[model samples]
Target: MNRIREIFDIGAGFENIIEWLTEEADWLFDFIALVVEGFLEGVNWLFHFPPALVMIGLFSLLAWRVAGKGVALFTLIGFLLILYMGYWSETMDTLSLVFSAVIFGLLIGLPLGIWASRSDSAWKIMRPVLDFMQTLPAFVYLIPAVLLFKLGPVPGVIATLIFSLPPVVRLTNLGIRQVPLEIREACRAFGATPKQMLIKAEIPVALPTIMAGVNQTIMLALSMVVISGMIGAGGLGNVVLKGITQLKIDMGFEGGICIVILAIFLDRVTQAFTTKDKS
Candidate 1:
């Protein structure tokens, strides 16, 4: 056992690789920082630019439309409660982080998923990568994110994106690949191009599954908010963190309640989308 350990020296090997990457990948880090910053700014603006009341009304209307009156009412009351607790701004910041991560996750995950669905080689490559992403502890993502983006909401968003990305990709690939072979053959027999078959038949059939992925991704992003807060991401996570440090039970309770409310609200809204698609 000692000899095998000495021969392998996995820790040393891992450390060496990390050191090499850090030394050689400065440009890559800068590029990621730029892209993350752009997304962070856009999402932040979207959540922050409008007055809080207007934003609340808009979200309430959206919840009503998507999830029906019950969810809408809950959303209104939840937001009002957060506002009354003086955590409105923090909640908004958390929402911004989540939205930004989801948008980017979808943008990247969907295409990769589609590609993986269409090609055996791509699927093989992505399978292990997705496994690694999904299996790693969520907090581990924050380290690279902080190193690349140097903390703040950008790092938070990046970490959240990494953590939440795999489900969508995996589900999208599953959904598309699960398309009935007979249907695919029929489309080909009808002289449909690959693109047409994909656009008209595969994606539509697969949408429900994809939407489920979206719901999962959003939930994962929300779960990461507090972890991200540790690295200066701010938001309700920060409030919770403060409460933890100061031993303020009331503050912690308020933050926890708000987080739960937001989670339920988002889960319902996204699930509604999936339900609508199925209907």
Candidate 2:
């Protein structure tokens, strides 16, 4: 068995493919890195524009409006606690990372989801690919990402985006597929164009499920962003990474608390959207 496994050497073949892609894809990677860096910078600026307190208040207000007074109050207090712990800027940086990953994941996942929902063959192909993506070890993404984009938030973004994509795609496909048969038939009977029916009837009903997927994607991205910090993704992730490696328990704990606070805030806000129709 050992001899047969050694002879198979599938791992080496994958390594060779990675090596080839790394050597051949420099221009493509450079362009992607440029775009990702610019996006990160823009999002970072948005998060940093106002005073930390002001930004906290703004987010709190948004939470109040969308989620509820309880969530808003929690947002205010949690951010204030992070600020008091002196991790506010790092927290902002992490937010920018999560935000960027989610946006890109949605852009890629949503279209693929739509395609899969509309076509059986597309779903058949996408199922295995998405399953592979989700089931693969999260850190494995970092390996190729670093080879392609090097150590930084660019690779981090790439890794996080890929890690977080599957839930949104799968849930989106489910949501659309689950849209009622009657509504689709009624739309067709009304002589609604396919485009109009899809846009008007299908998506609206599917939105709650899709939003749930988005929430899951955000949570999943948060997990990867911290891991991505090992490659210089920056943000609170690096703080936690340094704290652990250097044995600074207080620092590690503080960084972790901030991440938890941020995660809860985002999770609550996004989850609230999923409950909108129910409410």
Evaluated with TM-score, which candidate comes out highest?
2
- Write one digit per residue (lDDT tens) for candidate 2, span 198-239: 899998989999999999999999999999999999999999
State each model's CA lDDT, in order.
Answer: 0.90, 0.94
Model 1 spans > 4 angstroms off: 1-7
Could you tell me the lDDT of residue 67 within candidate 1?
95
| TM-score to true structure, per model | 0.94, 0.97
The per-residue C-alpha lDDT of model 2 at residue 136 equals 97
Where's the lowest-lDDT run of ten residues in candidate 2? Answer: 270-279
- Tell me the number of clashing residue pairs for each predicted model: 0, 0
